[model samples]
Target: MSNNTVVLRLARSDDLAQLSKIEQTCFSNDRLSKRSLKHWLSAKHALFLVATSSDAIVGYGLVWCLKGTRLARLYSLAVLPAYRGQGIAQVLLSELEQLTQSKGRAYLRLEVSALNHAAISLYKSLGYQVFGAYSDYYGDGSEALRMQKRVARYDGKGIRLQVPWYKQTTEFTCGPAALLMAMYSLDTKVALKQVDELAIWREATTIFMTSGHGGCHPVGLALSAIKRGFTAQVFLTQLSALFLDGVRSEEKKQVMCTVHDEFITQAHKLGCVLYEKPLELDQLYKLLKAGGRVLMLISTYRLDGKKAPHWVCVTAIDEHCVYVHDPDLDASQQAIDCQHVPIGLMEFSKMATFGKNRLRAAIAIEKLP
Candidate 1:
């Protein structure tokens, strides 16, 4: 349950059957044909990676490495339902970046549906910036946001350590670093020298981060990162999300609180910093000055009253600027001006209700180290 236990190497031709199944299960009506999967399996510059749990494929990703340069394109990524909150897709992504970077790739690119907020948020949190949107990019005429990330050069020699996926477990049990010991004992049959390939559905009652749910659920990922000596935290807010897809109104507070508490506790136990409510602009600036990466959870309310509560990551900040994931924006650019962004704090807090009282407060910050 902890550690970068899953080994990500190259996908073999035999993996076509499983990969095809995943594509079908993940893409709904947009599933690719077996023939297409075969093409990707044999792709020369493309790398396919499968996330396995005791040999069963749980997730996958595909990346296209440019032939003559260090640029790579992330074509597709997915993780099965039961395996999602575990951060399997992220591991596959970070692995692809490592694979491409090893090949001298400097830039990473991908296109996501304009409505797919989860993908947009994850990529931005991982250091990707948006460029622009391609109208009607999908066959169904849906728009797509293009995103890209620049990989830092590798200076460490020896074998590079594989990164682990962050998981959210309700028990708030074992940390990821300790969980890694278990992962290291697993068998790795993957063949590394071969090419790589890439390939989530929302299930109900399972707690979606995008939906505002108040409860104390541990973010397994922060614990995993802490175990590895990396400062990791989960970000959440008390405000209602304006655009969540599948959560109920009464459940929002519980979902958000649980997710927030879990990440904070795990981060603290792992020796990372934890920040709770009443966070001010000065406190944020001070944290950044301490010389570490911080994940800020900002809340957005849907003034239109049709969407659910949501949150985004604050990746960068300055006196006059704040850079965030802003899943609502197109993915091909770096940051957006705070003034033009969606759902400000004041607009979000007004949605919360305590018994007969409807509060207009728009913001609350809980920091996890």
Candidate 2:
């Protein structure tokens, strides 16, 4: 087959049956149903593409633009067995990636069975990097490797500011992990390792957050940064004790209070500035633009389905959105595992609050001038 003869175009309603047939023929398990294919073919914020030869469908690729973030997911891609090795899959992927980038998405992410060496090789050849793995991701108990590719965008110049990212090793360490990223961005000499991560967690942990070992409060995290010789400024909308609503026991509340008191004393002693009002989004943008790093507390419900407070680093900001380095890693999705995930400013503002108190906290850090 000649490459020039292959036709690539957006899938239509009539192509659903052929796409479903290709799905059934391509894999033993996790095949998309005909109904699902039909729905995705017409769904908003999604792209269904087909590659045809001689007016017959040979392969298809499905991608989803994640709402509220400048990222896209390659939900599935498949080529007919007999059509394999004819460059059909490559053609489909190339067109899909270009379509996604043209929509202003910065990353293309997908998951494949870890045992599928052929697919993995093809993805790597196309510059995809494996960032995480999930056990038993499929119905057949097979592991899946999450991979991502950066959709490069240049404004006739260079790229955005690159910020270092580190994933939290434990569930309760997102604050410390995010803090470490901000600290590292401000001072590259600061080393990041398991021990340092644990140490920072110990220093900043509130003893009890919503559940597990208490997450780091904004004051605690700011103290950790200050102790590391970085100038830290904390912005909080409320002055009340942090994370007290989730704790029912008076003793636990007192412990939280004690921790908050210690952070306040340390802040006063070290001359760390603590703003009693919320950090305006514009201020955050200005800080990032002025070579400062910000660690923000956000509700994970926006990124994942979990309604929990999580911390992430503000790496860069553009005209329409802010780029974040999320410390919490999702094994099943590699885009969330990578750095510089773009979140729209309005969505970010809505996601930055926690609890009934609507607590909004952020810490901006920079090396001493």
Candidate 3:
């Protein structure tokens, strides 16, 4: 090998000093501290690599791969000023993409400073597309552009519903957005609008869950679907007051109980099917096969490391994966990231629970034939 040949290797504790120096020289702000660098050097969730030329650390790339998810993130990639003209950045990025695929991840996501035109050009040249942006995202108050690239091809023979992606307009309206998606998938005549979303939220909210506006209760969601002229069934593990654990104030708890009770009563009066049982994967697959659309409550911890109850539309399923249309789209996520998200069968189950009680709830909807 030539003396200047750039060699890439896993970052190690021994290279901490040189890596720190390089980081400080490359980035004026938002530089990782030595402690963080040391932590990531050994963090299993992070893949840290260093590029060396003439046995000197010249550049580095980082990949944050969360366990049990088909996603990886390019945390950072920086090359020394002297090595700017060389293809070292491209080489490091390509290797990172390959490693992402090796870890069974389909997408490699990243956030880059919006002002960095050269870096943005490099990413675009390497097949990355800008999907979304975050305002005031950096230490210097610079905006960040979110980009993602498909690193691995999904080989599943997918069985998916023709559902259009509709992002929730608010932070707490995922349930309504999901319900609308399911309804639209079953009947294309259904309109997706914020007015209807808020309307459903008013009917389906649990009054007060946590400190926010409120979360959608399963019973309320099922009842909301039924009221819309769609045949609906709720598969739930518990028949008691839902989302109560997320509330603390006694007055809020009482209001939630009253709302849930009314919803349960309405479901009974309307002859809604309430299957009080765990939603088995096979059973869910059969429902999908029968052309039933699903609105499932899931914990967002696996998807974004935020432990909160979130609703998503189950648009499709296959032998190896279950695809969902997530209604909650943060600035970091585009419609591509939220639409037809392929979660592995096992990973889907793990993400389908919420709270310490591990509450599992799903609403199935079908068109009246």
Candidate 4:
């Protein structure tokens, strides 16, 4: 195979040593460990492609498919010093983008060293745009520039909101955190404080869930926003007590029902419009276009199989994807992964429901002029 043309192929376990060698040769620091390379070769949501001239591997590119989102991340890419002028890096990267799009991803993202002018030039030449940056992102204390290229085209009108992210202080405060992000996007004077999170949770809690802190109900959440003097609207598929099947305790169920009923009554009194229908992304895009902030409820089951309700602020929406600011940041996820997340349009529609009852909920809020 050493005398043949440089062919591109999927990486295998046997290519581990060559891949590690390329990584070491191409990068002075921040090299991928053999263990990690081995893992990606078989990872369910990852793609590792290699370029080989005959037998020896000349270059490689790896991407991680962000599950439940229309996003794939180019984790690493490199070529041997001898192969630098052969355009192997570009070939590998282009193939990575095509593969990523074939997997239904709308965007392909990557982080490169801020000082890597050659790599940056290549990325720009390939239509990748700089979106953000990170300081001291590498082991050698070098900064990194975050870039992403839209791979799949969108059909719906895309709208992205300028929203500040606030991670939930506690597990049960995702609703409050999401709400605060939306509120602050509309009004800069609004504060993202722990006290505010707890207060909103107190006002919006369903009172009980399958276990620990109960999730927030759309009615209660809308009411919370109304209390804060923002105009609010709610969309839901059902109006009954939610998460009832999760808990078997009749007392807990009743407590949740009581809270739910109270919220509904207050929402009605406060003139919150309750739409007995599903809130589609097209509708969300229009709201975003009109400068309305949205907080949406989704099941964590689709995200991590937790089967719990989670709140995320809708930052933007298009026909192909729903951009969101997730308040529930796991240890495995970086801040970039949680901010302005792009959940695929169809994937989001499925994930926007919760429990056996398949409850769908969304709340739109706007500053009163």
- Top-lDDT candidate index: 4
Best by TM-score: 4
TM-score against truth, every candidate:
0.41, 0.73, 0.71, 0.93
**What's the distance in Å from true for residue 236, model 4?**
2.0
Q: What TM-score does structure 1 among the candidates reach? A: 0.41
> Which candidate, 3 or 4, has the higher TM-score?
4
Of 3 and 4, which scores higher on lDDT?
A: 4
lDDT per residue for candidate 1 within 1-369, as digits (tens), equals 222555565788998888888888888655668997799889877888888877877788898774433357887898887777777878889888888778756567788888889888988889888866778777788888877776636322111122122222222111221222122212123211112100000111224434333211223333443443444433323323312333455576466456545545545666654333334545545544553333332223332233232223333344333333333322232222111121223332232321122311111122223
Over 4 Å off in model 1, which ranges?
Answer: 1-5, 154-369
Candidate 4: the clashing residue pairs are 1-54
Q: Per-residue lDDT tens digits of candidate 3, residues 70-129?
A: 767888899999888888899899988888889887778888899999999999999999
Query: Each candidate's root-mean-square deviation in Å?
Result: 20.1, 6.1, 5.4, 2.3
lDDT for position 206 in model 1: 23
lDDT of 4: 0.86
> In model 4, which regions exceed 4 Å deviation?
1-4, 153-156
lDDT of the structure predicted as candidate 2: 0.82
Misplaced by over 4 Å in model 2 are 1-56, 64-68, 75-159, 335-337
Candidate 2 accuracy as TM-score = 0.73
Task: Write down the TM-score for model 3.
Answer: 0.71
